[model samples]
Target: MISVVLLGSGNVGTHFFKAIEKAENVRVAQWFSRQIDSIKGYKNKTAITDNLSELMEADLYILAVSDDAIATLSSALPFENRLVVHTSGSVNVHDLDKKNKRGVLYPLQTFSKGAEMDFKNVPICIETLDKKSYPILKEVATSLGSPTKRVNSNQRRVLHLSAVFVNNFTNQLYRIGHEITESEAAEFDLLKPLIMETAKKIQTLSPYMAQTGPAKRHDKKTIEKHLDLLKNPEHKAIYKLLTKSIQNTHGR
Candidate 1:
């Protein structure tokens, strides 16, 4: 069995621990957090520590901390030359201190505290500075039942940027829609089906082919009506920008 030392107790780290708990071939040997209380609940399951020197021997050391902390934390590890990886999409594999074998096991999905995540559905993007580390990281990812893809640092950065557009930006648009509906005393829930249908369409149809509505149709009257209805200048600006973007995409 592959033993893992999980360092960090945030959303990604917490989820990784839970997923590994269910995996048959891998187990978390220890969990580390700056503040022990963050992972106090898991003390019954695995060794938990706040001191780096107390870290036990393990097959893998996963630094699932924030992107900014990866380098500093890796450098501070008491042991070295072991397989060390960080769960960051944008951070380069080489960012880890050269004291150990460095790699990345980025799970390409949004994570939130208290939300349920199915590990089988999350895509794991793997990158390693040393060639031999690839199979080890791949095996760990496979144990989690996640699909693995080999991605270079540059590719991972692009993937992360695209994710921000699709997930973060799209969620902000949903917030704006909620605000608009509330202003008109309309039920925002009424748009739920449309949202789901739009997502479903992109599964079988290319986003370009699935395009619909006023902007895609070049319905200037409807577009103007929307812009006029948006009383908030910020909302109107976003509407205009997105409308222009859609129009340009469709050659309207």
Candidate 2:
């Protein structure tokens, strides 16, 4: 059986715990959190503790904490020369304490507290200098129904930056769209289908080829009207910047 000790009580840790619970041949040996109350629910199911000295020896110790806390936490682990991994997209696999086998098990998706995600559909990115632990991580991903990929630190960094543009920046644009609709006393939900279709289109078509907008078409009048409609200076600036970027991309 593959034993995993999850160290963190945040959204990623919580989601991983649920995934590992239903996975076969894998069991959680213990959970570590500074605040025991955060993970008290799992007390009856598995060992939970705030003390690092009480940490159990496991095949893999997965640190699912914030990027900033990863290095410090891994360095403070009591044991050494064991398989230890972190679930971060941007953080380096080498960030883990060198005393242990370092690896990255980055799931390329946004996680929310109490949000249910289908792991089977999520992509898991793994990177490690020690290939010995690859099988264990691969098996865990397979059991959780996630697709696995080997991504080195440099590649993972680029992927994280792209994710920021595609996911984070896009989400901000959605919020802006909602604000605009709300200002006009319109239902933001009305744009849901359009948003969904925009996402779906990129799955089958190149974004450049799929591009269709006033900016892409070089419709200066329409773009001007959109900029004029925005009451917020920040929104107008963003609109102009995006419009100019699109025009330059398409040679409009």
Cα misplacement distance, residue 20 of candidate 2 (Å): 0.7
TM-score, prediction 1: 0.98
lDDT tens per residue, model 2, 43-158: 99999999999999999899999999999999999988998999988888878889999998998998998788889878999888888888888887888889999888999999
Query: What lDDT score belongs to each candidate, Candidate 1 first?
Result: 0.94, 0.91
- Which residue runs of candidate 2 sit more than 4 Å off their true CA positions? none
Displacement of residue 241 (Cα, Å) in model 1 is 0.8
Candidate 1 whole-model C-alpha lDDT, 0 to 1: 0.94
Provide the TM-score for each candidate, comma-separated.
Answer: 0.98, 0.98
Q: Candidate 1, residue 203: CA error in Å?
A: 1.1
Summarize candidate 1's per-residue lDDT along 84-163 as a digit string, tens digits.
Answer: 99999888888899989989999999999799899988999999999999998999999999999999999999999999
Looking at candidate 2, the ten consecutive residues that score lowest on lDDT are 113-122
